[model samples]
Target: MVPGPVSNDRLGASNGRSSPKPRILVPEKVSPDGLALLASDFDVDSRPGGLSPQELIDLIPSYHGLIVRSETKVTAAVLAAGTSLRVVARAGVGVDNIDVEAATAQGIIVVNSPAGNIVAAAEHTVALLLATARNIGRADRTFKDGKWERGKLVGVEVGRKTLGIIGLGKVGMKVARMAVGLGMKVLAVDPYASADVARQASVELVPGLADLLPVVDFLTIHTPLLASTLDLLGEAEFQRMKKTARVLNVARGGVYNEAALLKALDEGWIAGAGLDVFTKEPPEEGSVAAQLARHEKVVSTPHLGASTVEAQENVSLDVCSQVLLILRGGLPTAAVNAPLILPEEYRKLQPFVKLIEKMGGLYTQHYVGARGGMVGGRKFELVYQGELAGINNTRPLFAALVKGLVSSISDSGGRDVNIVNAALIAREKGIVINEVHTRENSGSTYASLVTLRSYDTDPAAAGKEERGAEQIIEGYVSGKTVYISKLDRFTASFTPEGTLLILHNYDEPGKIGGVGMVLGRRGVNIEWMQVASLEKGDQGDKGLELSKVDSAVAGMEAHGSNTKGRGNEALMILGVGGVVGKEVLQDLTGEEGILDVSLIRL
Candidate 1:
């Protein structure tokens, strides 16, 4: 498989001064890491402050990618002018500022870094929840003003309290877990979350907001600002809460109506409110949002939910990674508007989409084409394990995998691949699809795992399953990152992102140096490398899987069937940054003790 047009057109064209690379427009301040990544492969125009709608419309036509934060508004008019745009990405989770409907109609992908900032947002929610219960913010302000009215400022206890939550997403689940640890009994209302998911978090699921409101001592919200959720909490909802109850919001603005919240405070419907977001940021002096923030009973902060350094870095990398993947003819899982899937299911499967597609891309590039086209396999094997295997419809996952396969093999940028047609394309090409579902075990190392291997038959007979490559790659998602847990028999911590160079060599001195010398001469920088050799099998890298010397001895005694278990074999998986031509790989293979090399891009 060859690098698709995204690399050859956007990336390879970028290698010289004659042809311009894909251009990305950044309208607001984003992480420097993201900026650097975009700048390396594309022409970047960064303004940080923002662009007016007219300025954006005027400038969007020539750009291929656009990266924004919450401030930049991607209007329909602006999108209409973005004739060349391939993607519009938000550096954080929300895409409210981006005209998603317009982007979808134009066949442009809309993506956001949803996984990156959940922890930061969840922690901030807890901070506000506690600050409101204990009157910590008002206490700090009054104490700073030289008043110490401890009796009047006395607060309530949260332990053993009944906590109510709206929206059981990643952030909500985390908040629920934290509340449970603090001895709170949690009840939640979310249409998307399964009862099993909530039960695992030790939360009791309720039917709706109505069912949840009346019994809460503290109510917290963590939902998006959509039509249904807009003004989700109003006077009527507030009236149902306990007179001493408190509420907090750190998710998005306007989910709790501003005027209604003020009335709740004024009427003493609820004890206090904690807010980290406003319908309008920096609300005018006399506006409802401003009044809510200034009220003596309200504990407010500027929208700082995703403000930590770690969150900034994570979001930057996550968004940039998707943009790069899409530009390079790959399907990105973090898309807000993908074709032919229900909105809710897309949301649930986004991260796993990235994981499965990457597995397919990796398998096709290194195993399929490298081993020769259409081997003995009757179909590609996909195995699902853990809680996610219960998904009723997995066609989207299959389509995503096939799209990755074509993206790795074709040069058309995979622009035609969509959830509806990827499976159809595979059938037309004589490639069969197979799947197996299994449950997660507590004794297993990973909570969820997706395995990709080749399933084969004699072709003449066609009834029985046989091993094709027998090389399996199992992918795992932890927190916000996707990694390869097991690549064949070796346990691994290999994050299959960007460009990777996998080298198989003999366990001998200078083998590593030989490959390094070739790459160095070619100006290809090795950003990271994972090594596995028989001599130091006890430990190699911090998280990478390594082959052992003892295993090699056992393998040799067992007649040397396993190549990795041979007494003098080693592996080097390198994360390379910068362009490497076929010449570099040819030169690498010519080096002594180097048996093979595979360069996989996703």
Candidate 2:
């Protein structure tokens, strides 16, 4: 049975002090033991049966921390209200419920218990695969119905079947190992992964989706939801699968096209399906997910992959420990979307970090310019300060930074991009990568500054540069905007979509309006625009300062409330044009305008 709510009055109690037990509130179901432990050290409060958005909005302001599961929506509103909230813990692996951007912007650390659910999700996948193959659930129902039709239920043998796995991540790898032990031949396809690694897992790696689609008797999907994977298994791809093949998805919703899948099931495009997730949850009573559950050929469950006793206990313990640590003024190990800088150090550089990261996002988008292929790969570097050694999971942030940089260029196509293969890919494409790490205890207990560089060859252009790779793009996230610190060198920025119009021209009158007018005339809608400039030798524009650009940009106090029409141009990102192979820099700068345009990648 599900748990009940905790007393809200007890939750409201706080020791009269400027610094109380950094109150952590668990609004989702957590293990009793974990809660007891937290109550001993923290002014803990917890409840079950997920919080409605408004209730969460109302309660958020009262706590220093919050915890939840997939059912809760950690929207921007919750983040805005929780001014006192220092940390948020998701008692499960996936953080799809949390608005990571909102949390990060507000300096709230978001943690997830990923390791806790791995074993359970993997084991559940195996159980479903076996159940689907043998029709165990169907056989039991039939037998209870007084129909002994053993002859009609002749099950397929797994010993000789080729099990095709779409993703080779933690769950996929576990499935492959178990399938192989059961005498099934395993073939996997993962473009971003190494074939050598798959072979090491004792599975054969096939080329792309086209090759694996028609040959397998069973297919399983395990991947994240991003631009590329959105609606991945659509109508055209469904037609490629053999009619006898069965498919399974236990990873994320929308990874499969539900409409296409239903048609496939009805049209016999595929034999059957085994699903643990859907585009929507517990699905409406007569929805496709529910309808599919009623079909004899399909096997279903209400996302039971992480429902095991062990997984729940693990998640509860993991989140409990994380909340405790953060309340004690230490950063969490499983924070889902917190930026690389430490909390204390981050406070110091908060203003600049936002500017730098935003700039880096835009700068990256400018050079790579909406192109899909790998640009002359760029090198990544990070300088670490005190206590980084304790945080073993910092690697994901590094990859996220690279992905953020790449996303600025090719929003949809650059997602699979990661730090593991980023340098290698850069090297293969003749891009150089350099890394630097520094440990110091002077500034803050824990702090870091990152720098990303790229060769001169533009990601939007087909041409190569004379310099091996010009330092075309760079930026980092640190502290508050007005008082940001010089955490890194060079101001790099990138946008997430379409050609960017980067203007570094003289910051004179009418530059922003001129640029906007030029782009508008060229049929480009200004999606989002940020302008930054330094008053000669001011606090901003200092050499080697990530915060300098943001200080300069945010410092320009608008003349009045009506400040939309004009400003000096420091940088501009446009969602101009759709997906294309070429850059459109010439159009914005060529027209009679004050801004000099540099067409960067989407």
Candidate 3:
């Protein structure tokens, strides 16, 4: 039997409510404990079987809050029908079925139990890993069929084996702890997590998947399914793994290529696989996932990572607590949208937020174009200069900067990259963050400035010059407009917006015309341009000509004679209308005096 709603008076005068209790609608079955807690302070209407879309739409208008699990699809239509709904809470980590944008559009807060089922999912991952390693599923099935296949059930031991974890998030970290307890060596690769965080967990931090793949006896993925991580473990990755290695995916379905896994298993590229989720839930009868489930070397389960009773109760309670907090006019801890920043402060920081985000995006893309990839190491430093340094609250701006920096190089999948989870995602990837606050003007021309730099920690490159070893980008707010003031050593004042193409070239004649010809031939229009040249001292060109000349060349002794015509490096920053294609890029690079080129889209 469903529990009856409680009166608002039961919550006492501290709740500041003399009116009727807030009405909460539970369209899907939740833990009884969660319902009882809601019933203690609010009116709850629960339907265990869950209401159909039309039924939910018809009943949602009367509720002040709605709580649901994965089964209920909170579509835009339902959100549109929810005239009085103030909050929509999901009892699980993934809100795949919830239209969060729709809820936000209606000014309804959407909350999720991000950490409630973490342990359950972690335990489930370990269970699947063990099951796959020991051939427990096959053994149990054959024994139940009355066949004694003892000799065929030989298994590998997980102890002392290397386990490579793709993401060290809440569930992933728990799995790391459990694996360590089981005597396994853990190697984690997360671009957002710092080395200190990994050291605290006793896991070796690897920078890339290639570094982790060949060494691990077991490869388990915990990263979200984004454009970068979709089909993360495909043919190439499977080929890199040891033939005796096992693969596990308890995070998401699309993380591993199902067809590739089937082929890997059939071709003996991997020993076994344990999958709790699939790209398509309840995979087609004859699909690769279904075939893999029937394979002797594979162990598969329905999506049950958070299926435990304890996990269900925890998520239900967590989300319910958030719903109650919001209804009581308190801020929620796990809100997945813009933070509850005060209006006055928000207005002050709004322009800076956009400025820093664009700066970060431009810097990362510029670095990748120059170095052929993302920044080498995980450590990054953020400096707030001039008037901006005096602001006590800069967390939101920092988060925006990180979101912009990481989102450009990685795939966020369906998850929204906002201030709330940006730092969380950054930490999961082992990205070290150092923030500096200073009130000194530092001779800045603007009232405020934000600078981001990625520290290169390569031992081999430590002895070399600093020019190509690090990345630094700076921006500032002028009045209401935001402009990028500097990039590396070249100084420029240009609005960091739209599509931009940056070129590093010799400070010689005809270079600009050559680049312009290439862009013109490709039908690309230049909206704006900024040029800056490296000073003689800045380029270390003071004694370069003298050192290069022999004593026999007496007339060449003067530095002016050797370098008067050219040699100083210059930068051309072009704001273009459309994408600068590879062909145009190649032509630009091949032009005389051109050294490097990078394109950034903001």
Off by over 4 Å in 3: 1-19, 360-381, 386-392, 402-445, 453-470, 478-482, 492-602
Q: Please give the ranking of all candidate structures by lDDT, highest first, separated by commas.
A: 3, 1, 2
Q: Candidate 3 residues 1-602, lDDT tens each?
A: 00112233222221332337678889788898877878878889888888989999988767778999888999999987776677788888877788877776766777787778888899999999999989999999999999999899999999999999987777888999999999999998865555666788899987687898988999998877764467877898899989999999888888888899899999999899888998887888998877876888888899889899999999888888888887887656666543423345676887888787787778667875344444324567889888888888877777777667765544332123554466666665556667898887688767787888777556567666333356678888877888877788777677888777888877655555566667877878766666654532353232221221222223322322333346577677787875566677888888888889987777
How many clashing pairs in candidate 3? 11
Clashes of each: 0, 38, 11
- Residue lDDT tens for model 2, 467-544: 444443333333332212221222333333345445554444444455555555555555545444432322233222
Misplaced by over 4 Å in model 2 are 1-20, 48-62, 71-83, 96-102, 342-602
Candidate 2's TM-score reads 0.62
Sort by TM-score, top down from the best: 3, 2, 1
Better of 2 and 3 by lDDT: 3
lDDT (Cα) of model 1:
0.74
Evaluated with TM-score, which candidate comes out highest? 3
Q: Report RMSD for candidate 2.
A: 12.0
Error of 3 at 406 (Å): 5.7
